[model samples]
Target: MLSAGFIVAVVFSWIYDITPGGIIRTEPLPKQKLPLINKKVKTYRFTTFVSVIIIIGLLSFNIIDSASARKIEKIDKTIAVLPFTDILPIKYESIVFDYIGNQITAGLSKIDDFNVLPWRSTKNFRKGNKDYVKMGDEMDATILVDWKAIEIEGEKRLTIEMIVAEDEKILWSNDYSIKNSWTEISVISTEISRNIARRLRTFLSLEERARINEIPGSPTALYNAYRGRSIAQNALYLYEMGNRKTDLSDFDVAIDLYTQAIQVDSSFAEAYANRAVTRLWGIYTTHYSGNELEKCLEDIEKAKSIDSNLIEADIAMGFYYYYGKRGFDNALKYFQQALEKDPANVDCLFYLSLVHRRKGNWDEVAELSSQALENDPASALFYINIGTSYDYLHDFEKAIECHNLAIAILPEWPA
Candidate 1:
């Protein structure tokens, strides 16, 4: 006969059901993925790069910069370009500033030398004023770019500054006037990105220079894409700032932002996918009505039909299957497809782990969660999944230890 403790362990294990991926992102896995159930996940995980210096960070998208980011690995190489602020006389011209700010970020992302933090990730740092040097250290950024625009009586003034990451020294500064059309904005932004890259690398390759100069042949399409990206970027900013609230306010605002993007460019497939995912999150987490869920599904289908190769489209379909429709089999397929394209996507990995758990594959759960943890070690949910798997295996000691680690990260109960 089985011992009383063994029976109790099995009973308690079945009673455990904790969900991950709230504010700080997480993925799931089965028990076998974890080498030892009690082993703590490693932090300071780096993005895939050939350089010896690892980027010691996530973006400042989180409401608060984490105190646990002990050291910034490559301060000299990592750069952060904040959204441009407006000191315009006209209030509504602020949208123009948003457009220019996004152009700068998108421009920098194309360069290979620096790890540019996405525009959405810099949203939280837009608070009126702060110490740029301290911000650089907190963000693990070695180069800091700040831009501001002022428009008055028929003249537009633009100022750009680059700060040294170690000490907040302005290495380069320029002030120029925007005397050209809106189309000139992209050209100006690209030149700025190239200037920064050139400063860091000392010389730009032929390809790098070409990429910086490349603009769409049709000026109309170029303008529309930039405008749509700006609006979508704003929605993403709201989403990041929302930081996983239980209410639908954050998701709803993001939906509105994407709606504006679609209005500007009806064929923006990525914007549709973003809306669908945000709506889907609302459907699962908030008290969103069926209409929103239906809209979410519609957006997903529309995005998939529009751009079959979009990774976000695949991720939305996966979320729909797993969380919205409870179709684990289809969810697994879609998520795997998404991960195959964007191998380092932390969200897709965590959601896939959850799907494996539903399929009753504890070993798969361990494997998925473990890999996700390598890229996202601070995720409490990943640790929780590993802990639960050990609990089921009657490794009570390891289980308790894992649970304690999760508690340390987040003191609240995991739902």
Candidate 2:
């Protein structure tokens, strides 16, 4: 109330004068015209004028600040890729569709013009008849990549469209027919990237253009590598899809897919790491014993040997130490290392929080879980972790608030 009265008094004094004899007078302020300055004679008028001008300037600055924020929001270089609709008779052709989607996303990620949403982030939208606009809004993206694929005889037909999320307008569309070979997928991806980049009119440097046309060493090597890469990608797609089932069957299908990936690419470190992660899950369920455990450890070690800097390998090590060896400190160390490599990684932050939770470090748990939500806000697990941390800290109100947020994101889950 005191602050409010002070403000009101200041505002009233801006256009009036007060005398020492307790009289309020409506006296016009005298101005002395001195060269480039019309200086006010009264101290109150000078101060009030300066205050009013400052207030007006602040209001103008706020208006511009709001407008600039809106402009920045509309100028986001973000896009979401919906899983390509497969209209083939073969049910298993879903893998091909997924692989094609992956290739296009990977190709576009190479361009500096836009950011492609991760597959994990978009896969959950495969429920019901998804509204493109809602998905785009949820992802905070301006563009949506809606695509479809059809396999006819020995050729594949692909159709892709870019929709402006705000107005549901088609920004660009293309239809292409090519040989149903693995190499052809990359060809389609590059052509689509080039066409979309041109439509966006983003200034592409010479080097970026050159990347769009990069070729393999030789035709023979290109054929094998592309084919192997697609096979591995499709297998990974299967693994990811199956892993969402929330049952032991997830391990079954994901392991088979990883095996297929290894068969196609003998030196695939990522495939090894993914397989080892599933194996770790199996161990947690008491499904792997003796020789099987040894094999899983070998796979984890082999993945680290192949790629010393693989984040997935680091995550696998973290999990191995936590679940298999019961070494919480070592697990936390590796998880922290992985988080350092990719601070925005959802799994890294969540798993690191899990370790903190185990150690009864409620502060650390809350911090890590909150950080995970920064990258993947839709993750109900992270919210749950935060709620659990609050619960441990005896903050029931905050715990309830965090749980409410989790419930809002995943209403069906009774966490």
Best by TM-score: 2
Q: Residue 10 CA error for candidate 2 (Å)?
A: 64
lDDT value, residue 328 of candidate 2:
98
C-alpha displacement of 235 in model 1, angstroms?
A: 11
Q: For residue 290, what is the lDDT in candidate 1?
A: 49
What TM-score fits each model? 0.54, 0.64
For candidate 1, give the lDDT.
Answer: 0.65
Clashes of 1: 13
**Model 2 C-alpha lDDT per residue in residues 119-228, reported as the tens digit of each score:** 54554555356576777777777888888776667566778898878778787899988664544666677788888876665667898878776532222233333344
